[model samples]
Target: MGIIWSVIFSGMSFYWAMGGRLGVRSLGGALYEMSLNPSPSFLAIVWLTGFIKLLGAALLIMLLVHRHNSKLDRKLFYTVKIAGAFLFLYGALNFITISLHAFNIVNYNLDHYATFWRLAFWEPYWMAGGIIYFLSAKRT
Candidate 1:
C-alpha cells in the first residue's frame, strides 16, 4: 500500500516536473500557469525538488523490498525510519502550507476550486500516507 501511494505521488511529481500537460483546465495546468510568472530559478528549484522526492520515494520502496527479502538489520531499520521521517515531514509541510494558503484566499473571498480540493483531499492523502509509512516503519 505504501509502495502504491509512493508510486502515485512520485508519478504526479515527475509529470509536473516534466511539464506534461494534463489539460488546460486541470489543476496541474493551473500550477504550470502559476509557474510561468515565477523566476526560472524558482521553477528549476521546484523541478529539482520534485525529482529529489521521486528518487527518495523510489529508494525507500526499494529498501523496504530488500529488507522484506533479507533479514532486517539495525542499519536498514534506521535508514527506513529516516526515509519515513523525511516523507512525513515533506508531506506535512506541503499540506500545512497549502491549507494555510487556502484559508488566506478564503478570507479574501477568493474561492479557488482547485485549492479547495487540494486542501480537502490531495494534500491530506499524502500526509496520511506519510504517517502510515512512519507507523509501518516502526516494526519492520
Candidate 2:
C-alpha cells in the first residue's frame, strides 16, 4: 500500500514535470500557476520530487528482497523507520499548518482547493503511507 501510494504520487509529479496538465489545478495557488508554464528549475524540482517518492517505494522493495544478509537487514530497518518518520512528520505538520490557517491561527497562502485536499485527503494519505511503511518494515 505504501509503495502504491508512493508510485501514484510520484507518477503525478512525473506527469506534471513532463508538461501534462491533467489535475494540475488540484495543486492550487502558485504551484498550479507554475504548472501551467513551468520554468526549467520548476521542472527539475518536480522531477526531483518524483524521484524522491520513487526512492520511498524502492526502499520498501529493498527491504522485501534483500533479507538474506542480517547486517543489511538491520540497516534497512533503521532506514525505513527514518523514511516513515519523515513521511509521518511531513503529513502531520502540513495537516496542522492547514488546520491552523483554517482557524486563522496562522496565515498561509493556500487557496480553497489546496486547503480542502490537504485537510481531507493529501495529508492523511501521506500519514497512511508512513504507517504502512512502518508496518511493512516491521513485518519484513
Candidate 3:
C-alpha cells in the first residue's frame, strides 16, 4: 500500500512534468498557474520529485523483500521510521492547517482550490502513505 501510494504520487509528478493538465489546478495559487505554463526548471523539479517518490517506494519495497540480513534491516528500519513519521506529520500539518482556514476557524491565507484538494484528498492520501509505511516497517 505504501508502495502504491508513492507510485501514484510519482505518476502524478511525472505526468505533470510531461505537460499533463489533469488535476494541475488543484495545486492552486502560484503553483497551479506556473504548472499551466511550466518553465524548464519547474518541469525539472517535477521530474525530480517523481524520482524522489520512486525512491521512497523503493525503500518500502526493500523492507518487504530483504530479511535475515540484520545489519541492512536495522538501517532500513530506522530510515523507514523517520520517513514514515515525516510523511505522517507533513500531511497532518497540512490537513489541520487547511481545515482551520477552509472552515474559517482561522484567517490564514490559502488558495481555495488548494484547500479543497488538500483537505479532501492530498493530505489524507499522504497520511495513508505514512500509515502504510509504518505498518510495512513494523513487519520488517
Backbone clashes, each candidate: 0, 0, 0
The models' CA-based lDDT, in order, is 0.60, 0.85, 0.86
lDDT at residue 116 of model 2 (Cα atoms): 86
Ranking of models by TM-score: 2, 3, 1
Estimate TM-scores for all models: 0.59, 0.91, 0.90
lDDT for 104 in candidate 3 is 92
Q: List runs of model 2 lying over 4 Å from the truth.
A: none
Q: Model 1, residue 67: displacement in angstroms? A: 6.7
Put down candidate 1 lDDT per residue, 36-138, tens digits, no spaces: 4656665676577677656656655665564444455555556656767776677678667666767673232224766666556666776677676666554
Shift in Å, residue 44, candidate 1: 3.4
- Which wins on TM-score, candidate 1 or candidate 3? 3
Runs in model 3 deviating more than 4 A are 105-109
Our model 2 lands, by Cα RMSD against the true structure, at: 1.6
User: Cα lDDT of model 2 overall?
Assistant: 0.85
Name the lDDT value of residue 22 in candidate 2: 81
Alpha-carbon deviation at 46 in model 2, angstroms: 0.5
Q: What lDDT does candidate 3 reach at residue 130?
A: 85
Top model number, lDDT: 3
Q: Give the Å shift of residue 41 in candidate 3.
A: 0.8
Relative to the true structure, candidate 3 has a C-alpha RMSD (angstroms) of 1.8
